[model samples]
Target: MPRGKYTNHKGRNRRFTNPEELEEQRRKDEQERRWRQQRGDESSESEEEEDEADKKKASGSKTRGDDDSGSGSEDSSESENSDEEKAKGVSNLIKIENPNRVQKKVKKLSTLNEDLVSQKPQLSRREREEIEKQRAQAHYQKLHAEGKTEQARADLARLAIIKQQREEAAKKRDLEKKQKEEALKAKTAQTQKALGKKT
Candidate 1:
């Protein structure tokens, strides 16, 4: 029944009893109060001051309106004169160009010199084909020397058999799909004819 204690039906106190724990709790509460103030939750004092200033300004404006009714035209004319004077002052002002502004010099880039660029040796079509043929012959000679020609041939045969089997399976699936579609179309035609006869 103490200030910060609670008891259930079992009658056990659910509050910290140690002095250190109470001190820690007080410190935590103080820290939270400071945080709330920083977050603008405790700014009622400043807000009250602002409200008072706003009320004063509103009352002053109402009193000024009652007194200024007779002088409204004069006030408007004075304002116009002030605006014209400001415009005249602006028009009489001289604009001085900055003496320290730098003038940029345009530079012309030099054209590329054909002689300075290194050129790759150009091969004619016949020469390119001959080079390719030589490379192929070299590669074949290397494979033959390594006794891999038979193994490569066997691999190619196996790949061909796999490709042929895949093609045959695809063809069989396509034929079966075509037959099913045709049967569906025939059934639809038969149903339409029977409906027409009944009508």
Candidate 2:
């Protein structure tokens, strides 16, 4: 092995941690995790709900007080709208700021993302080859059905050769049968003529 500062050399063996120290570290990690989880629960939607209730109670009190001031009620309502808008902005920021919110997926708004979305997924070599073979087979089948493919032409040629061979064999059989019948008839006629001459 290539020796380096981090690599264990012949003179120095790898260091081992004590089991007690390992146990302590594990305990610390568990405690820290639980503490973080408790904080996350406290800072979650429950806090938002409480804030909303508080806002509503404050608005109800303001509306009651504004009734005596007449036009102040309308202005207060508008101010409340602005306040809610600002709160909405803060709410978005708060949601983003939450430590426990794990951003597993990043939204990429670009031409590359659109192109990637439109493109087919990556496939294994065998899968790609299988898909290609299927496509080729389907294309050939379609062309064969239309009698427009080379394979269809070759099949027709083979069938024609077979048909021609069959026709030739049939013709040869007919010729042989006709020849045999003619020979038999000639022999019988000659025999009859000889018998007549003798009688």
Candidate 3:
């Protein structure tokens, strides 16, 4: 139905009154009508249900409280039965047999003087890896402590180049990750027709 005259950006015929086009338009209008009707029916049914519940509550309030006590007790017993069944399959994660024993363990660990321990302080995972790399490069230096200074210098130069290359690679990977996230957002918007929904 040539209802509006806007350019066909995606290059379909600008006029839309042809039989196939009219049928497609009719289908769309029918779908929209069904959606609106469903929403309206749901709202009316809920209003009726709420009114019925309010009427029942108003009538119940006039009765004596003791009249519903029997039903309340039955509900309480049913809930307790279900709770017991639920507990049968449940297990506690940490069983604390004696709280005092845990306190003693904490005290013993804390009371030890730091300086008295002859062992070297432990390195963290990353620090240990860097330390191992430094040690391996310095091994050639140790043999040449009394001689051959040029070999030690060459080894240190090589280690510096390796560290620089690793840093550059890390930066490249971070840039790629950001590009991938942007592409995914664009693809999701296209697939879900979010741009069309806004219109």
| Each prediction's whole-model lDDT (CA) | 0.60, 0.63, 0.57
Number of the top lDDT candidate: 2
Query: How many collisions between residues are there in candidate 3?
Result: 0
lDDT of 1 by residue, 167-193 (tens): 999999999999999999888889989
Better of 1 and 2 by TM-score: 2
Off by over 4 Å in 2: 1-102, 105-125, 192-199
The positional error of residue 136 in candidate 2, measured at the CA in angstroms, is 1.7
Error of 1 at 122 (Å): 36
Q: Which sections of candidate 1 miss by over 4 Å?
A: 1-148, 197-199
**Ranking of predictions according to TM-score:** 2, 3, 1
Model 3 segments more than 4 A misplaced: 1-148, 194-199
Q: How far out, in Å, is residue 17 in model 3?
A: 99
Of 2 and 3, which scores higher on lDDT? 2
Candidate 2 residue-wise lDDT at 183: 97
Check candidate 3 and list the clashing pairs: none
